[model samples]
Target: MKDIVLYDRNCHFCKASKRLFEKLDWMNVVDWQALQSVNRPDFSQEELMEEIHLITPKGEVKKGFFAIRRMLLRFPLTGLIGLILHLPFLKPAGRFGYKVVADNRTCTFRKK
Candidate 1:
């Protein structure tokens, strides 16, 4: 079973992140889903929109930087980087960086 990543489809930044992840997913260990397609009762629309969410095969749910961290560890290509991101000194920065991107959904880049 593949791990699932839930993202906001309407946000171009979110879409870009999804595309970037797709490129890094050499093993195809993860599956991407739009929040609109998800029907879980525990996940509120408002909450899901706050950041990208990852649901593990074992039913563990992680959001924001933690979600990205968990997903990265699944692929051999990014496993080392994922481990590095988990360092205590980097966790705060990781979360902050993800939050900055997530908070600003207005996409500056246009499809050419």
Candidate 2:
């Protein structure tokens, strides 16, 4: 039971992101589960695909930029990025940025 959990598999970008976090703090504030690794009644594949997924030990679920922001808070560098997104006016911009990234992620990882 990790304190923070992110839903991701071997996605190239996701793996890259995870590697960066791993390099920063071996303390391991986060855990990851491939979509296939768990049966989550609360979220369907369709829903998960539409947003980033994060679950806290408190059983709170957060999605989109909020999820990314949550993960960023664990590390100093990323915490800065997260703080930027936390700005009220920047929230919508952060969401737009996430959608753009999410929409383009398939270019890097194609399904067989």
Candidate 3:
């Protein structure tokens, strides 16, 4: 199991997602971080602002839906879904969906 680094903040959805991952990640594989967690050792702010990022134990950076997929990999059944999410046919839809969720995050989280 890889150490999952999730770059998120105080957004309601982001926080909810983190909690959900915590529930699903039975092996204690994830290390959640706020975008403002200044103590992060692996990722820089510039790198984070460039995209919604996640880093695996192998240190491979994933962004967008791929990051979501990486988090899902912690669960057995959901891991299969994560693999399917990487299919070429689903890439465009996944990217678009991620953008929709991200764009609405501030509003949904009442951050603005």
Candidate 4:
């Protein structure tokens, strides 16, 4: 089973982010889905809207920054970045940074 990343298709930032992943996913280990278009029984609509989600092959779900880290680990080019993010001292900071970006994504894109 492949890992799936659910994102908001309607958001400009989300679409751009997906394009970046498409370019980086040379191994083709990850799949993409539009959150608004998919019905996920395991996750509520509200939960899906709050942040990005990565559904692992083992059925585990990683959300927000952790989701991005998990997806990054599968890409050889980005694996080092993921490893750095997972470092003991940086994990919290990574999560915080991701939240700040996630929270501001709409505004950032809207200004474009």
Top model by lDDT, which number? 4
lDDT of 3 by residue, 1-112 (tens): 5665655664667777677777888877778767776566676777675457777788788887888877776577588888888789998999898888877876765534
Error of 4 at 17 (Å): 0.4
Give candidate 4's error at residue 45 in angstroms: 1.2
lDDT of 4 by residue, 2-111 (tens): 89899999888889899998898999998999999998898999989889999899989999999999878888899999888888888889889989998889877762
Work out the TM-score per prediction.
0.90, 0.82, 0.78, 0.93
Candidate 4 TM-score, true structure as reference: 0.93
Best by TM-score: 4
> lDDT per residue, candidate 1, 1-112, as tens digits?
8889998888777788789989998888899999998998989999998988899899999999999998788778899989999899999999999888777767554556
Clashing pairs in 4: none
Candidate 1 stretches greater than 4 Å from native: 107-112
Q: Give the Å error, residue 74, model 1.
A: 1.8
How much RMSD separates candidate 3 from the native structure? 2.9
Model 4 residue 8 distance off true place after TM-score fit, in angstroms = 0.3
Give the higher-lDDT candidate: 3 or 4.
Answer: 4
Backbone clash tally (model 3):
0
Instruction: Give each prediction's root-mean-square deviation over alpha carbons.
Output: 1.5, 2.9, 2.9, 1.4
The residue-by-residue lDDT of candidate 2 on 1-112, one tens digit each, is 4544455674666667667766765557777776667788988878876766888888999887888887787666677877777789988888899888877775765555
